[model samples]
Target: MSSAKLSRRRVVGAGLGALSSAVAGVSAGCTARSGPPRRLLLATGPEGGPYNAFGAALARAVAASGSRLRIVPVSTAASVDNLRELDAGAVDLALAMADVAEDAALGREPFTRRAAATALARVYVNYTHLLVPADGPVRSLRDLAGRPVAAGAAGSGVQVVAGRVLREAGLGEGPSPARERQLGLAESARALREGAVDALFWSGGVPTPALSTLSREVPLRFLPLDGYVGPLRERYGPVYTAVTLPSGAYGLAEPVGTLGVANYLLARGEVPEAAARELLTVVFDRWSDLLREVTAGARLEPRFAISTGRVPLHPGAVAYYRSVYG
Candidate 1:
C-alpha cells in the first residue's frame, strides 16, 4: 500500500481506539428490528447550495442501496435552523457547520439551552466566500464598511460566520456599520448582480453551483479571509481554519485565502442504533456519489469523519467506527 494509505490506517486505528473508551458501557440497544424501511427526514440547506445537492444525492443513494432506512431530504435555512429542527423532533438528521453545531451543543447565543444532537461524521469543509463585483469599489474587508452586503439567510451557518468576519473587520459595530442583508445563495447572487448588495457571504464546498453560475454572468472578485482565522479561533476555539479557494474555481485569476469550517452530518440522540449504523454504511459505501453532487475534490475518510470536536458521536456512529477499525 502507499505510504499515505498506511499513515491513514494508523491514524484511523489510533483515533478509533481512543474513541472506543468514550463509548464504553454505553448501550447500543437492539441491532435487529423488523418492519418496512423506516422513513427519515434529513434537513439540508437552500435549493442551490452544496448541502441541498449532497442531501438529495444521499437520499437517492440510500434508496438505491436497498437499506432499511429511507432518507427524505428537507430544504431549510441550514445549520442553526437544521439543529433547531432536529431538537424539536422535526427532522431525523441534519447537515450543520461545526461552529454553529458547537454553539448549539454548548448552549451559546441563538440557543437558549443545550441541544441533544450527536454527529455521524464530519462530512466536508465549507470554504468561506466573500464575493464582490470585479468593478465594485469594495477592495477589501475594510472597504465593506457602510456598504450593503448580503450576510446570508437568518438561520444559516453562513450568517453565523459572516457576522463574525464582519465584526472582526470592524464593520458591524459602532457607527458606519455595513448594512446587513439576510438572503439565501440565489437571492444574494441576484441582489449582487442588480447592484443592490455590494458584497455577499457564502460558506460551502468549492465551486458552489449558484456562485459558479453567477460568475459566468458577471466578472467576480473574491476577498481573502485568512487574516480572520486566527482571531476567530481565539474567540471561538479551533473550529475555524485557514483554507484557500483554488484559482480555477469561479474564474478566479489566483487562489484566495479564506476561512474553512467543517460540516457535520448530525442526528438526534434518540435515533435507533441499528438505523444509524445502516445509514452510515450506505453513506460510506456510496460516498463517491455524494461527492459528485457536492464538490469537485472532497473525501469521506473515517479518520476525518470521527473528529467532530466537542459534539459527541452518536452511539451508533461509535459502533460503526469500532467495526471499521477492528
Candidate 2:
C-alpha cells in the first residue's frame, strides 16, 4: 500500500482506540442517574441552509442524550466565518465542511494561520447542485457563460465551491457570460423566480429544503458535473467527490450529477474529554432519530462518519468511536 493509505489506516486505528478508551472511562466513572449533564452551546446558521438543519438535529440529539445543550443559532457563511467563530470561542460546537475544517486547523488559504481546532466527526457529504428554470435558455454548464448565477451565500463553502466549478467550466475569466451572485438557496430561488438570477448553485445535501420547495413551484433543471469530477478531485484532493443527487431528491425532474465535499463537526483542540465522550454518544447512539430531524443526521453512521477523518480526531470523539468499532 502507498504511504498515504498506510498512514490513514494508522491514524484511524489510533482514533478508534482513543475514542473507545474515552467512552469506557466516561461510562465507568459515572452512573447515568447520578452524573450532571454537561451544558453545551452549539452554533448553527441563519436560516435555510444545511448548517441550520444539521445544527438543529445535533442540538436535539444532545437533548435526547439527557445532556443540557443550548443550540445557538449564529449567522454564518460557512468555512472561514464559521472557523473564526470557533477560534474566537464564540461557541462550543459548529457544523463545518471538512475541507474548510482542514484548512482552519492548518490555517491555510483564506485563513492566515492554523486554527488549532480539531475534527469531532465526519457528518455528511455536501453535493453541489446547479439549479435553473426548466424553460430557461441554459442547459449545460458550458451554457452558463455570461448568464447570471447565484453562487450561494457569501463566505459560504457553497460559494467557494461554486466559484471553483465556474472556474473549471471556463466561466471564471474576463467578460464571461456568467455573473456570480452571492445568495442562499432560498434567496437564489426567489431571484430565479423573479428573473433576477438565471441559475442557482448550492453545495449541500440532496433534497435540500429550499430547492425542493422551488422545484414544486417552478420547472427546475439540473446541470450535471459529468466531465469535471476527476479534474476537481485532482485540484482539490480528496475533498471533492462525484455524487449523484438522485431524482425526487427535491421533486426534481431528474437526478443531478454533481461534485461533493464532506461536512464535519469540529472542535477546539482542548475540548474536555468528558464533554467529547457525551457528545459522541449523542451523535452515534441516536443517529436515526437525529436524521429524522435533519436528513444529514441519518447518514452519520460509524462506518461512514468515522472512516473519513483526515485530521486528528478529537480525543473525545476518538474515545467514543473506539468503544464501538475497536
Candidate 3:
C-alpha cells in the first residue's frame, strides 16, 4: 500500500473511534450542493476481508474524483453489523452482501428493526470457499455429515451462508452432526493448518491473501456448491448465483463449482439525492482505476447494478444510469 493509501485507511480507523459520539449527527451532515458532508462513514468487513480492501479503494477513488464527499472506510463485522450500524445512525454508507441487504430490506432475522436504506450498486461477487485439507477425506458438502467445520464468525455474512450450506446439506441437525466452530478467515485458516477442523467455509474474493498463505502449508481442495445455488436463491433471494472458482486459484488443481453472492454499495435513505449521485458518478467514471486498485472491483458491471435484489437502487444511481444509457 502507498503512504497515501495507508494514510487514508488510518483516517478511517481513527474516524471509527470517534463515531459513537457522532451517530446522532450523521443525518445532519452537509451535501453535494452544500459543499461536502463532513465525512461519509462506510462500514466495511474485517481487516483481511475483501470489503476492507474494496472499501479502501472506493474511498480513494471518490476522494480523487474531486468530490467534496469524503468516504471514510471503517472495519466492521461485515453485513449484519453494517446494517445495524446503518439503522443506528452510526454510518452513512456501507458495503454489504446482496443477501444481507435483502434481509434488512425485508426485516428478516438479525435485523429486527428494518433499515431505510437502498443499494447504490451491485459492487461484486463473493465466492463460497468450502476449503478442506488436501489430504483429508472430505470431498464434498455431503461428506461433512459428522465432521468439524469452521462456519465463520458470528454476525459475518460468511457465517450466514455457511450455515445455510450446512442446513441444505442435511448437516445442520441430527445431534449436531457437523460441529460448527465460529471462526474468521484468518483464525479458520490457522485452525485448518493445525489440524483442528476437518473443513472450513470461507466466503471471499478469489485468492484471499490469508488463505493463499495458509495453502502453502496445508495444500487444499474445494467442495462444490453448484447444486445448492438454485436452492439457496429460492430460499434466500436473487442474491445467490452460481460461480466457478477458476483453476490455479489458491493453487487448486482444477476449477471448482461454488455459490456466489453479490456484494452491494448501500446508503441510508436519508442521504441526499445529489450526494448519492456524485458518489456513484465517481465510482462509474473512474471505474477502471477502481478495478485496478480493488481486486473485488474487477467484478463490477453496470448491467448488474440495477438488479441488486430486494434492496432497490437509490434514486441517485438510477438517475446516473439514465443519463448514460438513455
Candidate 3 per-residue lDDT, tens place, 14-95, comes to 4554343343333343332355354787878787577877676776666555566767777777888787777677778988
Clashing pairs in 3: none
lDDT of each: 0.85, 0.69, 0.77
> What TM-score against the true fold does each predicted structure earn?
0.89, 0.83, 0.87
Off by over 4 Å in 3: 1-37, 292-299
- Compare candidates 1 and 3 on TM-score and give the better one: 1
The backbone clash count of each candidate, in order, is 0, 17, 0
Residue 324 displacement in candidate 3 (angstroms): 2.1
Candidate 2 vs. true structure, TM-score: 0.83
Q: Give candidate 1's TM-score.
A: 0.89
Global local distance difference test of model 3: 0.77
Native-to-model Cα distance after best TM-score fit, residue 256 in candidate 2, in Å:
2.6
Reference-based TM-score, model 3: 0.87
Candidate 1 lDDT by residue in tens digits, 1-326: 11122243533342233224322211121123345667677778776578877877786666666566766666678899888888887778999999999999999987999988999999899999999999989899999889999999989999999999999989988788899999998899999999999999999888888899999998999999999999999999999999999999999889999999999999999999988999999889988888887777898999999999999999999999999875
Candidate 1: 10-residue stretch with minimal lDDT: 22-31
lDDT tens digits by residue: candidate 2, 63-136: 44545333334445666567776777655676777767766766677678877677778877778788888898
